[model samples]
Target chain A: MHIPNGFLDAKTIAVTSAASAGILTVSLKKTKAYLEDKQIPLISVVAAFVFAAQMLNFPIAAGTSGHFLGAVFAAILLGPWEAFLVMTLVLSIQCFVFQDGGLTALGANIFNMGVVGVFAGFLIYFFLRRLKIKLSISAFIASWASVVMAAGITALELAISGTTPLIQSLTAMVSFHCLIGLGEGFITVAALSVIFMARPDLLKEKAFSKKITGLVAGLLITAFFAALVLSPFASSLPDGLEKVAHNLGFISKEAPSNFSVISDYQFPWVKNKSLATSIAAGVGVLAVLAVGSGFFLVLRGREDGA
Target chain B: MGHSYFDRYRQVDSFFHRLDPRAKLLWMFFFILVVVLTPAQAYTAFLLYLLAVFVLIRLAKIPLKVVFKQSLIIVAMVLMVAFFSIFKGSLEQKLLLIFNVTAKAWLCLLASILLTASTPFELLLKGAQSLRVPQVLITLLSFTYRFLFLISEEVSRMQKARKLRDFGNSRLKHLKTIGHIAGNLFVRSYERGERVYQAMLLRAFKGEINTYSDLRFMQTDVGFILITTGIMLPIFIFSILFTTQY
Candidate 1:
């Protein structure tokens, strides 16, 4: 998800920003070593292709449509580093030009959607291929897992920022993304099948060494199970952990003083909090769809006039 | 192609449009940094920031409708977060969360929209180059911008052709067709990339992308920055004073 400004606190933003900057710097240097002059224009063109492809919506169900995120597909087509750069460019343009994502939160957005999405997807694909899974099936699984993992990370960020309770945000983000991931999987499979049929050479060039693939797969499995084990404990007593950290002089004792503007930081104004929230969500979805479609209508009108 | 969605209002002649692209870029970065760093509780400061953005929007002479429409995506996102906040803290806290998030996001979005709406995309890229953003990144961005519309047109053309022959109501069938289109688009794009590389090579292309635009900061650019700083300093002072007392 593209986190807007104000969604994350300063600490989360700073950490993510530094992390993304580091990864991008490393990617730039690594890409420079083997990236031939002939491939320069190709890289730009490929990035534009991804940007355009994202705008191409496919019908998923009645009255609904979805588009490919292209991270997994890009990584499979290009190398992972190239996909990372393409994603970074796309996200940056979306933030700066379209205001689709927040400037302050750009680091988090890029890290979640670009770095995590690309690397996780690539790693999963690599693992599956090593296991002799079909290319189409592996692409599907990798893209699906990538979407879900990115959503989980996004929820973790929100929880760390104290925007919502950890368990609830985690569950909500993961559940909703599960459906989105299915669509992603389908699209990735469909696209990969076609490419495999037509130009298998592109995929061949990007293959990893068997030793490296096995190592990555082992690391991924370990990390996945570790997260599974740690999540419940982390969610149960976040406040307790914070308190302990504060007492140990690791963190400041200050409660978010800036939040004092709201007067009270606990308790709902309405008796039926769930109902109120659902209504608000409905209203927001409707308003956004209406405004978005209206804007497109105006744009179309201008296009016709021109 | 006719709409030029990326630079819809860049041709407009106004103070903001006339300002050096670097100046506008600086204004955008400074405004966003200030807005983000301001404590969420600083309502007065936020209001002042909003006022400043509104003034800039006016000076840019861009249509309010265009700006608001462009901003709706950010508004929608913030609203979703606010909705979640309702299920969490006290009534006051929920309200505060919504207010703080909405104000900060809206201000930042407006500042960004102003920059893009007023400055042409090419100039913005040039400004970014002058700012010494990595050369490789800028090259990717410039190429993406140049080819974005063409690829979009190609996708639309494919979609139109699909609709013409498609009689299938089945979801799976539709997905299959979309997948094929996506595959075809990718292949076409790859081919186009190769042809473009060859063309660039014929023109004595090197790894370096050269731009001919010579961007120079003028007297007014300095004056504009000074004026913005003059306004921002007081807001910063007021926010600090207001926050500390509470």
Candidate 2:
């Protein structure tokens, strides 16, 4: 869900950052070991295609549109590590060149979206397909589950960070994402159907062995669920910290910046705080160029650079 | 495929635009860490950071209009993200949480925007490569950047084709059309990837891509970092010191 900075505290940020970085390192090693040089472009291109695909939104309902996240789709086509790498790339680019996400919260955003979605998508598809479930059906369920799980994890992170209450946020997140998941499920199945009909051979590549993929997926899923189960306790633990927090009384986030006009308590020396944020708005348009380039390539692709 | 749309303000001459990419990258990370680690109660610190970044934005000489529009969307997205969570907390806490996140997120976005807006994509990648940020990641990121606009163009063209063909408004049909487009796009890009490899092989390409570079960490780079941290240190110190009140 692209948890912006200030949403997660230093503690949650550190944990998620370390965990996501570790997973990414292992993923990079796995990918390098598994694929040969000639075949590597497929991963890069698939990542490109996924990034492109995310931009093309389909109308879900009146006044609302949804786009594909493609984690499960990538997992089914390539493998989990490739899928993880692809999504992480997409997210990081979104964080860096585009202002779609927060740089500081990259780890948490990657953890919630990349790690959780990839593993969930890969595992569910792997197992369901083994159980002889239809490929399209397995894709539908796997993609759906991945979205829901990612949403749940995102909400939990928000709760644990003291940004939101767990239960309400969890319910809202899960319920809202349940709709989003339906879009994911349908698109995934349909996208898989494309490969099924046109280029099914892409699926058979040995991105990783079946046993190892399963094992890694199982471990990551287990760890994710463990963190999910334990995090609430950590936040609400009757330990000295929570007691100290309660004692301190809200620790009062205080708007975190001088842009605290909404609060009764304003930061000192801010005569017109609301007007000051105009100064803050000075850095977010490149994504629009990326966003606008879809139209330009038709005219510009003939002569691009070295 | 289109490099022209990559960085609109890269052509603009300014101090930030002229600094080393590695230095700017460091400034970004350091600035983000300060934003992230500052206690949420530290309003003064956030303001200070925002002002500093704004100064750089001014020095970069980029148009403020583009930056402002981008940040508005980010703040709105934050609001959308917090819609569910905001209802649970007290009025003060809820307002504080949203504003805090908006401020911190806005600050990080500006810095990143500044980084990308000021430097061309190629130089940025070259800087990251020199930083040794996993050769594979840089490679993949470079590939993604190159093909990003092309794939997007393909998808848009397909959308146009679908519209031209009178693909009816059935939601079911809509999903299938997108699936078909994606599936079609996948095969297209995949083949392009294969051809790219062949092209690379023809050029005596090894596992790594070596772009010619002339990046060096100059005195300005050092000055930028020192000045950033110089301003940052006291705000950070005073903020933590102020946190003792809570």
Alpha carbon lDDT of each predicted model: 0.73, 0.72
lDDT of 1 by residue, A1-306 (tens): 788877777766776786577567756754674455557777777787887788767664456566778898898888777788889888887787667778888998987888778887788887788799988889989999888878887877775565655556677778877777887888778877788888877778373344353244325433532353244425445444443444355443223422332222233322233224323433443443354345445544754696
Q: Chain A of candidate 2: what's the TM-score?
A: 0.72
Q: How does model 2 fare in lDDT?
A: 0.72
Worst 10 residues of 2 chain B by lDDT: B84-93
Proportion of native contacts present in model 2: 0.55
Candidate that scores best on lDDT: 1
TM-score of chain A of each: 0.71, 0.72
- DockQ per candidate: 0.32, 0.27
Model 2 docking grade: acceptable
Across A61-133, the per-residue lDDT of candidate 2 in tens digits comes to 5577777788888888877877899899889877777767787689988887788898866777777877989
How many angstroms is residue B182 displaced in model 1 relative to the true structure, after the best TM-score fit?
Answer: 1.3
Clashing pairs in 2: none
- Angstrom error of the Cα, residue B155, model 1: value is 1.6
